[model samples]
Target: MNTFEKAAHFALTAHEGQIRKANPIPFILHPMEVAQIVSTMTHSQEVMAAAVLHDVVEDTSVTLEEVRETFGDRVAWLVEKETENKRHNLPAADTWQIRKEESLLDLKNCDDKDVQILWMADKLSNLRSFFRSRLRDGDRMWELFNQKDPEKQKWYYSKILELCDQLQDTTAYREYKILLKAIFSTDAINLQYQTGAFHFEV
Candidate 1:
């Protein structure tokens, strides 16, 4: 198997029986989409591999050392960077904002273009999923997240958008902008999801 195939298999196995919180779909699809998005940026096997394995250590029983041993040091490091820092023994509800804020700060100060591209790919894929789901379910979609407040979610995404804007030249970053603008419009006050009428340009 190629590097990406190997990583994909590992991620699929790690996430087996898991489903998307918003919808009852296989969790492996998220990593596959992430890998595809990163592929649009570069053909680097390590980046694609890392994208596929990004959530494994964060969301599954898989350990970072296992990823490092299986994928190598570089891919493992990229996965670590993509993984959210959840504090040990702390409730996610209590630390959600703090963890997100830390991620934003890390991205802001980050200088590595490859890492930036990988990060953009991940966010863009997530935004694409949100756009599709919102089109189908409207505001009720917010019920799926740990943080259910639409305003708070919008704030977090906006901050991430600004950090991503620095890499605006890339296609993935441009798509990220489009998704944000389409979903977080002023009409949000109407309690109606308007983006459904318009196709996601991403």
Candidate 2:
């Protein structure tokens, strides 16, 4: 098998029996969708492999060293950029903002465009899931996340849209922008009186 195939197999095995937090869908499907989104932006097998493997080191017992040994340096590096420090010792809600801030800082500081592709792909998959769940459950869908505040969620995703503006020409980025508007347009309107502008219009 090639790099992407190997990473997909590893991700499937690592995420065995895990399910999405907001729905009963198998967790592996999320990474598969992310990898698919990544494919729309780049032909690099290493980036695609990293997309499939991104959550393993962060969510499972798998180590970065293991990914490096199996997939080599470039794949592992891209995965590392996608990985977050979950700060498992504390309540997830308490740590949520800081973790997201750190992630944004990393994305802002990194010069590599492939890392942006990986991040946007993962986020687009998340937004797709959020959009589906919102259609079914409405605002109640926010209750499933560690950070239940929709404002904070909007801030994080909106920041991603700003950071990934370099990818504006890609189909993945365009879809991401549309989803962001669909999900947050109401919030933008609600805040219009105070902020004097619609923040999410694309």
Candidate 3:
């Protein structure tokens, strides 16, 4: 099997029992969708492999070292960049914003453009899922997330868009922005980019 096939198998095994909160689908579908999104941007087997393995470290018992041993350093590094640093000693409520902020910083400071593209694909797939869920369940969809505040969700996602602004020309980036606008209404971030008149707050 090629690297991507191996990564896909790894991810499916890692996420065997998990299901998406917004839908009853297997959680492995998220990584598969992310890989699909990344495939649209590049044909690199490593990038696509990393996309498939992105959530294994964060959501499963899998460790970065295992990823390195299984997939090599490049795939491990991409997965590392994609994984959030969840300060385990702290309560999730207390660490949520900090983790997200740090993630944005990593994206903004990333020297590898492919890393950013991989990250963008992940976000696009997530936002697309959220948008579809909202359409089906309306305001009830927000209840599925740990962070229930709509404004905070908007703030977090919008900041990611700002951080990934360098990729604005990509189809994933544009689709992410459009989904954000539809889900959150025309917020300051949307207006700022649309007419260059407003500044985003939070």
Which candidate tops TM-score? 2
Quote the positional error of residue 39 for candidate 1 in Å.
0.8
TM-score of each: 0.90, 0.92, 0.87
Q: How far off is residue 41 in model 2, in Å?
A: 0.5
Per-residue lDDT for 18 in model 3? 98
lDDT of 3 by residue, 100-175 (tens): 8888888878878778878888888889888667656667787877778888889988887887766788888888
Best by lDDT: 2
Per-residue lDDT of 44-82 in model 2, one digit per residue for the tens?
999999999999999999999999999999998999999
Task: Enumerate residue pairs that collide in model 2.
Answer: none
Query: Where's the lowest-lDDT run of ten residues in candidate 1?
Result: 188-197
The full ranking of all candidates by TM-score, starting with the best, is 2, 1, 3
User: Which one wins by lDDT: 1 or 2?
Assistant: 2
Whole-model Cα lDDT per candidate?
Answer: 0.82, 0.90, 0.85
Candidate 2 lowest-lDDT run of ten: 189-198
Given candidate 2, what's the lDDT at residue 7?
93
Supply candidate 3's per-residue lDDT for 31: 94
